[model samples]
Target: MSDARRPNPSNEIMRRKWVRQLRDALLLPPALLYVIIEEIFWNGATALLRQIARTWPVRALQKQLMALPAPVILPLFLVPEILSHIGGFWAAYLVTRGEWAAAMVAGIVIKGSATLMVVWIYQSCERKLLSIRWFAVVHRQALRGRDWVLEKIRPGKELALRLLRRSRAGIIRRFAAIRQVLAARLGFRRRS
Candidate 1:
């Protein structure tokens, strides 16, 4: 058999192992950062949203939103997102004017509220919105992109989650101690 035609199972396996290690080396730090940010920020927002979703008015609004047709849903979805960008830009202008606290408040109030609205409406009317061909295509593309990122970061995500699980109890205990100390310092009595 020619050298080029010879089977090389061991070499092929080694090459794959090397490639995987290299990929992990390159992607692990960013993946860990992504995990931390998602846990800290997105989880909090999602928890708050879940609480809001249980309210009577929000439930009624969700029902009304779900009844919307694809055409109406498209504008409803896009408008909030556009307004959010405008709010973000206004926040940036405030920053440029040295209005630090105003910028922070605007960012949290306007952009944050708009984000909640967009997420709520999207969750409410997702099926109706996806009935539109273009919207469905875009949604599919976004999902594919998300899937690709998740796949690339799978190993890192697993490691981060494992470490987080191991550290969680310690973190909670430390936070509880700190909270107690702060409360005592602030003259707040513990409720036995």
Candidate 2:
């Protein structure tokens, strides 16, 4: 076999061992932390909201509000998301005060309140909020702006992807060249 095509068992084993160590030492802990955070904050909040929505009074109010016109009810749908964002910032502020436990409690409470508000608005209005004239105008303008921005950035994104691919290929080629030079040096030394 040509030297380029020959498989080096030692290199393969070393590479596998290095990858295993990297994964165990560097990758696993961060991945586990991310999953835990997602489950606790996102999934837990969703479950809480679902449970609250099942109550009788909230359900009745939702039904009543849902029967109303879209323009009249549209403003209510915006409250929860805005409040939740504000609450998140507030929780972060609390954390800076060294009140980690209180920060967590505040975050949960704020999220729960926001989720409840959202659920109530959503159950009552559905997609009717989009039908409001002023809201529709703003939504359309926002979409147009987004499209314009994307169009402008599309060339830059493609350039970045192209550069990244080229850089990766160049690095691989350089590594192969270095490996060949090292192997040649080692083989000459062994023969001598």
Candidate 3:
């Protein structure tokens, strides 16, 4: 290739950097929202558990639950978590069917129910749950499956990045124009 037609290595690096930054900026809002929702759920669940634990009947039940073997108590602990996951999948199905209100209600109900179940499990049989061999095996297998799926999807992610890079300049210009229009409408003077 002629020197004039050659791609500059530094420019390639800069383009990659810009794309990564843009991707991060675009993703930040949703990631932050997820973190906020998770925090709210965790705190709310903990508070509810504390309130529940103060009841004499629940404390007595917890004492009885604590005496059970891991094999017996593990099923009780796992059942609620499995049901919550099923409810979430059902909500997703409802969303696909365009039942937005029903999906929202299902999501809320599942979360609330799951929170209570988890709190009860923790309060009642935390040690027994941890001691279950089959539970640990299942958890590890699920993690492995998640990692495998993510690995499989990585090539598609790279193809998307490549397409985005090819169109980067046009997208940047469109966004710049939008910024200028908004600045003008808001009576802000553009710096040269």
Candidate that would win on TM-score: 1
Worst lDDT run of 10 residues, candidate 2, spans 30-39
In model 3, residue pairs whose N, Cα or C atoms come closer than 3 Å (at least 3 residues apart or on different chains), thus clashing, are none
The candidates, ranked best first by TM-score, are 1, 3, 2
Return the TM-score for each candidate structure: 0.58, 0.44, 0.50
lDDT of 3 by residue, 1-192 (tens): 999899999999999999987986776554444444445665767765775677789889888888888888877777877776676677768989999999988777986588578668756776677677777777678566545444554687589889999999999899889867866775553467
- Per-prediction RMSD in angstroms? 7.7, 26.1, 17.6
Query: What is the lDDT, from 0 to 100, of the residue 166 in candidate 3?
Result: 100
Measured by TM-score, how close is model 1 to the native structure? 0.58
Q: State how far residue 148 of model 3 sits from its true place (Å).
A: 13
Note the residue pairs that clash in candidate 1. Answer: none
Better of 1 and 3 by lDDT: 1
lDDT of 1 by residue, 1-192 (tens): 998999799999999999998997887665554444334434555655786787799899888888877898888888877776676777778989999999888877876777677778777777788888998998899576556667777887799889988999998899889867966775554467
lDDT of 1 at 154: 80
Give the TM-score comparing model 3 with the true structure, all chains together. 0.50
Clashes of 2: 1
lDDT per residue for candidate 2 within 1-192, as digits (tens), equals 899899999999999999987865675454444333434555555544565566788688778888888866866767776776677777778989999998888777885577567655754565787667787787688566545445545677689888888788888898879767865764522344
